[model samples]
Target: MYSPEFRREAVAALKTSTLAEVAANTGASPSSLRRWVGRSDLADRPRSGRPPIQDTADQVVEALVATAGARISGKDYSTRALAEATGLSQSIVSRSVRGLTVPLTDVGGGRELSLVAAGFPLLILGARTEDAGGEDGGGGPAVPPRRIQRRIAGIAAALRSAGVGRWAQRFDSEHRQVPTDNLLELIAAGGSDRFLVFDPLGEVPVEVVAESDSRVEVHRDFAEFLEALKDLLAGCQDIPGSLLDLLSARVRNGLEGVLWRDSVGVDASRSSMSSDSMEISSWLPKETRSITEHLAIALREEIIDSAYEPGDRINPRLLSRRMRVPRASVDAALRRMVDDKLLDGSRGGARIPLITTGDVLDLYAARMAIGEVVLRSLSLRPQRYLVPVQLALRQVEASAPTRSGIDVEDADLHYQQELARASGLRESARVFEAVTLRLRLFISVLQLDYSPASDRIVSDDRAMFAALSRGDAKTAIEVWRGKVDNAVRHMAGLLGRRRFDQELWTQLTRSLA
Candidate 1:
């Protein structure tokens, strides 16, 4: 069904264009368009039937049975195969199978679906039942235990191809009734690894099956079921030994994409598995940033939050132990901060630097010089970067109302950095990044409260963004230079109040002797 807004748009177009034109453009049939025209309301009329069942436990059981039946009959099972066998819609079958399988790239660089080991018990039971019902109740031809073992071996091979390990460890630890020595010996003899090691004679407990049934009953749709499964696996501790319970945990973590490669051994430029991995990567709670980078960011935050005072010495060894990171990584991060002028490392160890008025002026002067070049370059093609520049300015405006001075300072720094990046000059952007880092340290050390000046700060940023949007390089540079001068004046006043030495300040400010 079309949304109300979509119907409104179609009806609105009818006043200016013919019904055929509107229908062709909107992809709605002419008959539907006729029914929608001249209506007082554009909203859809309510339907009067019960909705179709998109997913249910019964549907899942049916699909599992079909898959098992097909496997025993020497036929490949797919969504279409299951639909034909069970006389259900393909959509229903697909939804049921989604929780039961994982897609992995085969050696030939094509995606192939493999049933997870968690579902193996259900398949075995289904196959046994199908055999028993066949051709006059003599249990027809029994499925060979060797064939079942081979299937288990295949599932293990599929998982291994995708770089997954320890998949069958839970099965072995929780479900095995045999002694550890015997299991180890079996493994050493190359008898099907942990994946195939299950007690075929063991029966699933009634309570366990009932629990799964009750849980599935609460999930009204496939999405709810999927979300519940994710939450279950995410917080799962003391998972049960039953195969159904194991299925819930394994289905969430066992799915891994196989890296695709060409016949000549070079990695493929793009593949189905790569695309799937990209989609799934966002949901996985894993850090992509390196430890050193994370440490640097954390240290910067600590400094801005006043965790360290001026002239306070930083010990990397103690920091590594406190943060629980490698000493070398902490040292690397400290060195990086020192190079950025955020920490002073001159006297045998890193310490927070005491900011003087002269130091503040020098920092602002460096920024002004870099800003002039960056702003001028960006003006050459201002329209190409207007969106991101405006976004950065908006962030400053958003942080202006917050009581946290650090938030406003960080946002302002980000705005400056965005302008530098928008210039398209890579080398200048890198240099400007270092200058901004020093500026961040300058503000933090002086404990500048940006809340009072946030309005003016945001106003100045909006003016700068507007000037850049109009390709007015001169106005943009002047605005940036004025901001630098204002900052220098504030710092000089602050230092004067702190009783800084006038003689040393004058000597340091002398450009030439």
Candidate 2:
């Protein structure tokens, strides 16, 4: 039988892979994998008394606390406002608030809810008394057992009033079961704006706030956390420039502690652990991508940056030594990239594929056909589907004037990928991504040796954006067709300069026509 930890690792792998893939990697049957996922709760056990609390109830209580904090800070406390702040539905918030037994008075005949004066002290005390518990006696700081009990009572009362009494009881009891470091990593990777960890007393001893550039500010004190919350609320309503300025100020304040040691430092620290042990331990955190996946991405970047030329063989042993990962992992990554057509695996090993003029034309033709379908679907969808597309276009525009051709190419590729994703065509998006992988090799070669011109890329993309925005699918397709034809001609010219066969090039061009 697999251990709980083994099952947990398998479930984690399922997040970024298919069930069959996980089963093949783990040597487990598909049925067993499904069962493990179904029963993957870390705290799986039978409760003796009352029914178990649902995750939705937990979400509601957390939202209520955030709402309460905002209300006390003089922000808008209406259901709609609370929903926006907590990323919950307005109907859920309204239903939860109505169910709560807390003494709340209705403003505008129940259109808005306000906690009674006595309730405020309980929430404030609950927030303040929530200590990290290990601080006393060189651990950090200590609170009296009686004070802890009082804090628990107050928070439990609030939760009980909200019909989550069972959850309140489980709060203190289950705190130790949580893997703190793993939870922090997961929160850092999640999309939530705010996350709070209560320490039995309903006091938030750990709070994580998402910041720009994929960073998170972790606040450890209730007062300090409340101040950060105010900033978050203010930043949300402010203009983009002002919001970035405020974020920069906050980042500067915490820069010292935020800097982490590089992989070399981590490697140095892992000397005591066996390599097998380290590999197993790394798989425990769901937020941490698999080693093979990381290696694949790193190798992909190397290829896209033209570190390897066409027909150059990839040495897994040398890469393993250079990257400080197991050779097996490097081999697996090479195999994955080969499967994606980013590398050719013939001649008994993986190597960069030599590009042919016909190959370029074929890739562009496939991309054009897929792009037409995606663009048409996108035009038919609601306007909100274009948000990511717009952001990607902005990146392309911003990088156009930069001296780095690599930057411009990267942005343009991302814009196309985003366009595919926003189209809501999953299969088309997947195929488009595979086609783009081969296209990246050509683009890299052009950027490195040929210095292919890209003057029209930004203008063409902008025009397509405008067409898609106006729901003009015909114009968008025409613009895309023009862009593809331009790319084919440019690549053909580059190949001609390199002395490819004239007869083959002519035949390929005819097929395109």
Clashing pairs in 1: none
Q: Give the least accurate 10-residue stretch of model 1, judged by summed lDDT.
A: 122-131
| Over 4 Å off, model 1 | 1-296, 304-307, 317-324, 339-341, 497-513
Q: Clashing residue pairs, candidate 2? A: 135-140, 135-141, 136-141
Cα miss at 371, model 1 (Å)? 0.5
TM-score list, all predictions: 0.40, 0.41
Per-residue lDDT over 269-369 for candidate 2, one digit per residue giving the tens place of the 0 to 100 score: 11111243234223122364566545543454344321344676765643553357876778888888787677788865788788877787678778888
What C-alpha lDDT, on a 0 to 100 scale, does residue 219 get in candidate 1?
Answer: 28
**What are the lDDT figures for the candidates, one per model?**
0.50, 0.51
